[model samples]
Target chain A: MNYSNFKIPAVAVALGASLGGLVYGYVNEAISLALEAATPYVEQGFEVREDNWSGEVEPGKPLLVKHQLFRGNEYWFWAGTSWPGATIKVDIFDSEGNSVGLESFARDSFAGVRALPQKTATYLIRVVAEYSKTGEGLTDEERGANDPVEGVGEFSGSLDWGLVYGYR
Target chain B: MVMIENVIRIFGRAPLAGLGAVFVATLIFGAGLLNAENAPNAPERIDLSNFPGEMVEKVVVPIPAEIFAVLEKLDEPDWNSGIELPEQGDPVGERAILALTFGSLVGEGFIAVQAKNADEIQTIGKRVLALSEALGLAAAVRPHSLSIIEAAGNSDWKKVRDELDATQQTVRTTMEKLRDDELSGLVSLGGWLRGTNVVTSFISNSFSEDKAELLNQPGLIEHFRGLLDSMKGPSANSPQIRSISTGLARLEAIIAPSTEISEEDINQLRDISRTMLEEYYFEKKAAETGTSIN
Candidate 1:
């Protein structure tokens, strides 16, 4: 019941959490740069005329935005995270709640999907990213083992991420 | 809770044991968080099953160029009708009008590009410069306007179009970053009105099922309605915004929850859009000129 003994360890725990937050901020900046890298490829021939709309999404939690996409125009959506070793999944859906999407993958912290609408109507875009240290994809045998990496340099960190899209 | 209370009582009997236990617990918690911060321990795959995504209130509607691209690909519509230059008159400026004017000017630039009128593009580039100056956003918009002028000089229509696009973007972006959400919304509304005015005009003239179907823009109308609904302070309560909201509602009622639109409906919506554009963009009296700004 001595309060004095709990002091040092509590301080250390509090300090550890603060330090984790600081590191997360820096890692987030790196992830932002990774997201920007995907921009040039998605925007090569397009003239974007609207504000970039983005929002945060956690791992396994998909985010959806409904947009009025006209038929006969090519539109692209890119989702990214600052969290390293995280893979993003994006799905485009119809009003009937049918999945009508195929995602484009880049090995970095971003994923995208480009679709030319068959009907000029509002479509829902769903984006999700998952955090895994070896998100680079696992081998059949690696899947069988609990720990895939024999020796790893660092532990994976996962954080919130966002999305941006445009039309030419 | 009872077990933890009992443990605390036991720790009271042995202070040294309590200290060791506290230290060990802290270390374990720290390590777990570090494991969270560290690499290998984070889960690698994302399971999207049962994932429920939340809605983002802010919506960026597709710009005029989106429809322009489709028109160009399907049929090369004449740019002359859509390309009429905006008149610069009655030069007593106000902030709200400037905000709306900035958007309309950019919309005019899009029309000029579609026409491939370099002179008109340069004219609009100048108009945009003046509006930005009036709004004190010249620093952000000046470079894009300059680029637009120079690009037009080289007859680089594509580059000119891009610069015009960039000019509007820079202005809108700076306004948003400065927390001038009202100005940003008006700017969007101005652009939307002008763009739709011309689009409906073009579609009306063409009058095909394919062209008319493009007016099935229920999403965009709702986006604008939502934008108007979310407006705060002056921008939200502006008479211009109120009228635009009323006009948008009229348009939305015709478009929403409907797979088809008749020529009459297109003309009616176009009339509403053009009338609203005249009042807001040109400051014209509704009866004096309900036509789209020229």
Candidate 2:
């Protein structure tokens, strides 16, 4: 196996192979570093809906009040009924806790309403529903029962509208 | 004496043979190692004619300014004239919200579609279709609903009220599903992470000042040019470079103007990606071999 004769070529091959590997590793590391350096700031997180329950609404039964929120400039709101057949009235408020306007709708007949503001901002909004045609306050018993509306309903767990400003 | 001489002759010839063998072997080994290191890791510039992902991001990323402008056009109220159907209320303003609803869903849809293991995307898609159908129906029945409100002579604009109520129901249902689905949260996170990619960052930063202006720059073309350069560069074999290039190439084709991304582009990308992988594997093998030898 006289290795002495094959020394030159063996060493050359080994050298070439090693150098190629080293170069490759270095380039990979460089590119990886570049990618790391260029990683953009990804603003991804739970779109925290800002709460603006600042103003007070007229405490009336079936009272329709429009609450303004400086939120959802890029998104819309749809109406949802707790029961299959229900009539719901939603009142929106502003940060000052004042009734801005009122929006009324039927649950089963239609989908929901969306409001697009001139600008983006936060607002204090609430929804209350009643079966009565008169805008009167709900009785304690009625309030205790399965209320289908958001703020004025028996089920208040899902009523809190966390309206986010941006489409996150 | 004869056997000894033959042994000496063989030994004498061994060095030259070894040298030739080493040269050939080294060249082969070096070529293989370089190929392993340099093979394409990314997709090539695709022909846009058959691209399926062109509007993928468009359907996902919300361009607020564009949407707002559209809304304003739809809802611009004429002070002198009375409020007409589309112009009377804020249906146009509503357009902004609509666009986002669809855009965000589309973005999430891509992630859902890509999920390693999850049917959440399908659920979301169903919700989207439902919402879309609901909106279409509402749009058609809106006039009828308004008539119901007006004929009753309800003062508080009951017509408007009823329509809004309907809209609220649909919006609530859609948003609820979006929030409730476990995958929604995950999708958001994934989107955020994807946006953090180097290519994304570069474009975001580049277009920060005026996005519209930036879009006008034909990013796809520029990206293609850069990609071609990267492919020809000395480090073209690097997997990292190849992957980055691949990402860019795919994105460029997706954003390009040829309508659909062509099959050619996808094939090229796949080929490049495969080559890059091969190069990486072989280079790694060579390194392991070298390490073991010394």
Candidate 3:
């Protein structure tokens, strides 16, 4: 009947369960809203006035978002996920994984990449969210010569992430 | 001393399990911190040249309003000029036609917002509700329709426009989630056609290369071309899709390489878009009357 009898093991179990749910809640809900919110920034900064394409994605497995970017329009692509310590990356690429866009912005929960397609072309937008410790110190320049996925560690399970894009 | 030894033993006995417990606690703690107001990790710009992005096959380009906004910036645009009332016909009978009709109605909704015409917005809003029901998308679409009507009444044209955009997005995402990709494609193509028909008319009359520059949408054309090729069932075999496929390819050739959006090309695109919109509605009406198109 004494409280001290159940101290360490019980506390550790309780902590584990609590944190697991906390991370899942953000992954399932909060981050998705953040991605949608980022859509407006494209509208204001680039004068983009409408929704184009958007889709749901999961972490671990990468998503290839193919969008038809016109020649003259400047476009912003946003991707996000809410897994604490999870990496969200949105990059534009060609068929051979070449850089179609030179810049992508990322934070703990989301990323936005901009591309001004010089000509009408079909480009791939890769959005990936994952639990990784390696990406913390690595800059894009250092990973510049390597495949972006090289540093991504494996985390398995079904999780929710989303990406949306707009153009001016 | 006994408690410390027991704790160590608990960890040592399940070392891998111990690391897992620590990981979970850390993740949960971090999540809690992030959930606190002022999430420090607000998204930032990532322009990593070396980050190779993968591609998804589906592609949806920007909508008409995007170009419209830019045009508004470029000059005082007479949004009312190219705006023509859609000829009212009994909502197309076929489900496929209904999907396209839904897209058309939303596009009309966008125009109504632009013209600030409450009457047209209300009419379109009701029609959108009816069509969504017919398409079995009532649940996904009801709120947007109601918002559209409510916004129309308030004369919050911007709100009306947003609701219309939301309406279309809801329908497309719903369709996509349900794996009704073909219907999703039709919704997008229909809205696009309506917008293009109006824009082409505006640009053709004005004939500015600057305006025509927007029509350099070969990427969208390619997307449509691919969409048509991917169609299945009657929707695939439908004369409507075949013609659209051929039409987009031709348009793609004109605009491909995204260079020199010629006046001739714009005029041709306008003609094609108008004809397609007309043919689609006409066919729907014809199907309803049990009559054949010539």
Candidate 4:
């Protein structure tokens, strides 16, 4: 079997296809998770916007999104990821880097932050994702086995995350 | 470190083959930590120009209702005074003009909702349908238009507001999907101009600092200017768009200088929006009537 000639192309095709599928699947899952996280807010009379932002994010690197928010409207921003054991932090900041987020929650797969803007201006929504081995419902032994360093655990590479918002 | 030892132990009998892999993984993990360390803290403003993470480029412009909702809380300016129904005219043919009209019509719908003017709302709904048809978006917009009329009839102002927001979103999304980015931008710009005109007029009438502060949206002005600057083809060179570009520049100059818009600034903003809208509508009418708008 002369498999040498086919090796490079085979690897390339497999790599490309897997990478594409992973990204697509993760993005879709992230969006769904974000919407799920927004369910409580929606139930509270917050109208979830149809548009959302999604992309790959390296663990621990913060993603900043500049958005326009009007005063007198209470807003909730939710972010989600499909990465297992992921801890997502979402917050809203003003132009001067002042934290304007009111109530915020972060769990394993999703997080949310609320903001009642003081002015009608451009705001920055910052999201950061980090992996936690213990948060995945792992037992003590499993956590100990998987955990490598003090803060470092299993590296999940870049994660796909989605962000959605609602206003009341 | 323990995991690395475990790996070494697992391959300990195999000439330290796992050492290289562990070292590489450590370096990659270290690099991520270094990047995280380099990132600005939450209280430090990020420099967007050198932003490293993937920035979601989509900027969702707030619909007129959002701003109107804010205005409702500040002071009870007579929203009815802002509701001036533009004369019902022929359907616009040019896509750019139609898009602008559609956006402005939606803005009018918002004002009508604020005023609780059922008849005006119904009229704007019909006009919106006609303009959407002219812009080749009748199918997507018809349901919303119908809903708008129905909601207005029921005096469900909130539903009408939602439908109007949805209608604008649908139109913008459809345009983007069809690669009509320019038309989509014009729609937003039109809505913004009309909304701004109404807000500025209302604030100028009452002259409140808080209400005037709502007009502190230099970023939005810059966004619209960027849209105008990015327009290509004949639409880019059209007198209407160029005039809009000039108007936006004037607005930016007025808005970018101060955090709080003064009464005079409000009046100027209102006049700029009013003049631009009047010129655009007048030019369209003049073209239709075979009369020069000199």
Clashes of 4: 0
Error of 2 at B236 (Å): 38
Query: Individual DockQ of the candidates?
Result: 0.16, 0.01, 0.13, 0.16
TM-score of each: 0.73, 0.22, 0.67, 0.74
| Candidate 3 ranges beyond 4 A from true positions | A1-33, A36-64, A68-76, A91-105, A114-130, A134-154, A157-160, A166-168, B1-53, B282-294
lDDT of 3 by residue, B114-227 (tens): 778888888888889888888888887887789899999999876786677778877886787688877887888888878877777677767776667767666677777787
Model 1 interface CAPRI class: incorrect
What tens digits encode model 1's per-residue C-alpha lDDT throughout B72-123? 6555577767875556864345566678778887888888888878888888
Question: By descending lDDT, how would the candidates be arranged?
Answer: 4, 1, 3, 2
lDDT of 1 at B286: 43
Q: Scored by CA lDDT, what does every candidate get?
A: 0.63, 0.28, 0.61, 0.72
Report how far off residue B27 is in candidate 2 (Å).
Answer: 76
Tell me the deviation in Å of residue B281 in model 4: 4.4
* Number of colliding residue pairs in model 3: 10
Question: How does the DockQ of candidate 1 come out?
Answer: 0.16
Q: What is the interface RMSD of candidate 1, in Å?
A: 16.6
Per-residue C-alpha lDDT of model 3 across residues A1-168, encoded as one tens digit per residue: 010111123433333223211111122243343344454453354432334333444445566666655554556676655434555666776545566663456666677776766444566776677654445565554334233365542233433465666554
Best by TM-score: 4
lDDT string, candidate 2, A2-72, tens digits: 10111123433343222211111121221121112111111221121211111111222222222222221
Better of 2 and 4 by TM-score: 4
TM-score of 4: 0.74
